[model samples]
Target chain A: MIQVKNVTKKYGNFKAVDDISFEVKDGEVVGFLGPNGAGKSTTMNMITGYIDPTQGQIIVNGVDVGKRPRKAKKQIGYMPESVPLYEELTVKEFVRYMAELKLVKHKDLKEETNKLIEEVGLKEVENKLIRNLSRGYKQRVSLAGALIGNPDVIILDEPTVGLDPKQITEIRDLIKKLGKNHTVILSSHILSEVSQICEKVVIINKGKIVAIDTPSNLEEKTKSKNTILVTVEDPNNKMESIKDKLKEADEIKLVKDNKDGTKQYAIVSDTNVDLRKKLFDILPKEQIIIFELKKDESTLEDAFISLIDDSKETLKDNSQTTVEEQEEKNLEKNNKTKESKNKQKEKNKKGSKKEDKK
Target chain B: MWAVLKKELKSYFLSPIGYICIGIFLLIFSIFFYLTAIQSASIDLGNLYYNTAMYGLMLIIPILTMRLFAEERKNGTEQLLLTSPRSVTGIVLGKFFAATTVVLITLIISLMYFAILMYFGTPNLVPTLIMMFGFLLLSMAAISIGMFASSITENQIVAAVITAAVLILPWFLPNINESLAALDLMNYYSKFPAGLLSATEVVGLVSFAVMFILFTVIVLKRRKAVK
Candidate 1:
């Protein structure tokens, strides 16, 4: 078990990780979600005893990382962000060296090395020097290094960043297998991968954790409206009048017109209402043939974006009342304007060709 | 500590640095062997090791120690070593002893000259062994300095140049003031070449090595917070 209590890391005046607290129970797989520069790597470095936290404490298996580093560090197996490995050593040799570094007893060393090498599926390329191997193989070698000595906690930072789709799945499967026996903590920017592998999600933004819960719970919490997407064949444009018939409908937005003489609309209402059942009943009375109708379920990606946006809004609100507030507020406003202007220019360039076709 | 020491020693042999260092030492030994023993017709092997220690070590010590920590820092492999369960003291000693072992190997190979002298004439074995011991002490001191220089920088060339300058500059400093002779590594090594055992010199060289090794450990430990 890992308990991180009020941990904060600061590099000079800038706080990389503000005061944050969380815990990972034994045999649990927790996913750390954040955008870039959100202190994910810093927190992992502190937990692995690679760096000291500026404040608070990290206790792993009853050993405090700062107070008793040697005992605490022995329990952690960390694969740093870029998969640093000894390039001169062969895969098997590197794993053996890591096992030795972790203070594995002489008798159990060989068996432990072999077991970890096989578990990471590095048997074939075990003899090859790490410099000659591909990125995927190098990643496995690093993972094998982290898995040696059978540590209780395994921390992997951005493990799948540069992998291909097939390699990503293989690594994710390996992580899932590891989660069965060891407490696993992995950080990633990929939302779908997190939702698939993580039993709990911790969302961080701007160096502060915004939410921590199950993946489904996070999705449910961020979802504010009951909405349904409906595609219909409306020749005379009777869709706008249908909103008046169903009093439960708060807004109806025409999403897109399909090429097959049909149009799609988004119906939004109160969270307690089931808009799909009401839409299925009311469409036929207006002589509008229903092509397709489905409830719009919020995904993990939506939850991530909404949480980040909410954090930004709260930050803006807080900064508005402080000294030099006008300057800080103008800087953010200008940055947003420049970003949206660039996006508008890109959209205009793409739509120009479509305009010619029209 | 043994694990790191073993791997470092293996790495020295696996690369050409070990062979080159030993080979150069042997070449220098032969030159001194011809000049001091054969030309003078003296059975004193002490002068042979002394001359080589004075002229040959300045160049070879840097080559052996320059890449010890600099290369690791440059390639980011320092992360692997520092994150391990091994303490900083063990890691520093491991690399220190590994580099010292390369010098020991060279000294062992130089015994071929002693073997040749034994075949032709009976030489004083005790003084020759004393000279070898003194040479080991001097090399350990020089290697520790070089290792400390290596730890402070990531560029191998800078580390090499700094080590060379540190070893060579003290020789000229005695010209300005006689007190600076204590800084010359060769001054401490001079007595053993003349069949004299100086307890003070042995203590000086050993303490010099210990001081630098401790400094290296402290620097590395402090880097964790500052880095």
Candidate 2:
């Protein structure tokens, strides 16, 4: 189990992570989702004890990280943003070295290292030097390094970033298998991947966490309007009048024209209404043959973007109000400077145009 | 600490650096042995060790120590070392002793020179042992400074250059000022050539090695937070 409480990382005046807190229970697979520069990596770094948080505490299995780093760090297996490996060492040698560094018992070191090599599917290349391996193989070598000590908490930062589709699936399956016995925390900007592999998702934006819930719940919460796409053979041009006849339909907009003498329209209604069924029943009564009807399901991608954009707007508003009250004069001066620069560029373009005309 | 020491020492042999350092030291030792003892027609092996320590050590020390921390940091493998369960002191001491062991291996091979001297004439065994001890102490001090230089930078060339400068500068310092002779490592090593184990020189060399080792540990520990 890991508990991160009110952790914040400050780089001078810039805050990389702002007072974020979360908990990962043992045997849980949690995905950290955010856009780039959203503090997912920073939060993971603090949890893994890679860097000290400017404020707050991280406790791993009841041990405070700041008070007893060695003990706390012993429970974490971190694969950093870029998989860093010792290129000089062969695959087998590197894994054994990592086991030794993690203080595995001398008696079990060989057995444990070989087991990790087999587990990560690197047994074939175990004797090869890491510098001679491909990128995917290098990533697996790093994963093998992380898994050698069998630490309870395994933290991976953007683990599948540069992998191909097949390799991504392989690594995802590996993480899922590891999740059976280990508490796993992975961060990525790929929304669909998170929704597929993670049991819970933590959404962050602009150094602050905006939401934390299951992927389905987040997708459900942000879906305020019900939308359905319907394709119909409206030979009598009765599609425009369907909204007026069906009181449940709020609005209907033409989406596309099909080549088979049919038109597709997107119908919007209240969240509680099932417009698909209503459209199927009423459109047939009007002698309109329905070709297709389906409800639009909001994906995790929409939830992520909406949440991040909402938080960014709120931050911009807050900063704007503060600037108006405290630094109006300086703000005005900066705006004037920008305007003059734009005017100078405009004058240069006009001069060039006049020279061409002459 | 044992884990890191084992791997670092293995790496020395796996790469050409280890063989190069040992081979160079042996070559210098053999040349000095002939000039100082065989040509001089003396039974003294201590003078051979003293000249080898003065000339050959400066080059060998940098080669052994240049990549200790500098290469690790450059390749981002320091993250693995720092994040591990091992303490900073263990890691520092591991690399320190590993570099020292390279010099130890060269010293053992220099024994063949001693065997040759014994074949020609009776040599004082105690003084030869004392010279080996003093040589090890001097090498330790130089290796520690070189390792400390490696920890402060990521560029191996810069680390090697800084280490060479540190080892060579104190030799010339005594030439500029008479009082600066106290800073000279060779000055501390002077009595060992005469077969006298000076207590002050032994203490000075050991303390110097320990001070730099501690500095390296502190720099690595502090980098965890700053990095």
Q: Best DockQ goes to which candidate?
A: 2
Off by over 4 Å in 1: A316-358, B39-42
The native-contact fraction of candidate 2 is 0.67
Tens digits of per-residue lDDT for model 1, B35-150? 99999988889889988998899999999999899988887778777777888899899999999999998888888888889988998888888999999999999999999999
For model 1, state the Cα shift of residue B4 in Å: 0.5
Interface RMSD of each: 1.4, 1.3
Candidate 2 residue-wise lDDT, A1-358, digit = tens:
9898999889875788999998889999999998889898888877877778889999999999888989988988988888999888999999999999998999999999988899898989999999999999999999888887899999998899888899999999999999999999999989999999899999988889999999999999999889998889999999988878878778899999999899999998899988776777899988899988999999999999889889999999987987786688788889999999999999999999999999
Fnat for every candidate? 0.44, 0.67
Q: What is candidate 1's lDDT per residue for A62-101, written digit by digit as tens? A: 9998888888888888898878887878888899989999
DockQ, each predicted model: 0.43, 0.51
TM-score of candidate 1 relative to the true fold: 0.90
Q: Global lDDT for candidate 2?
A: 0.90
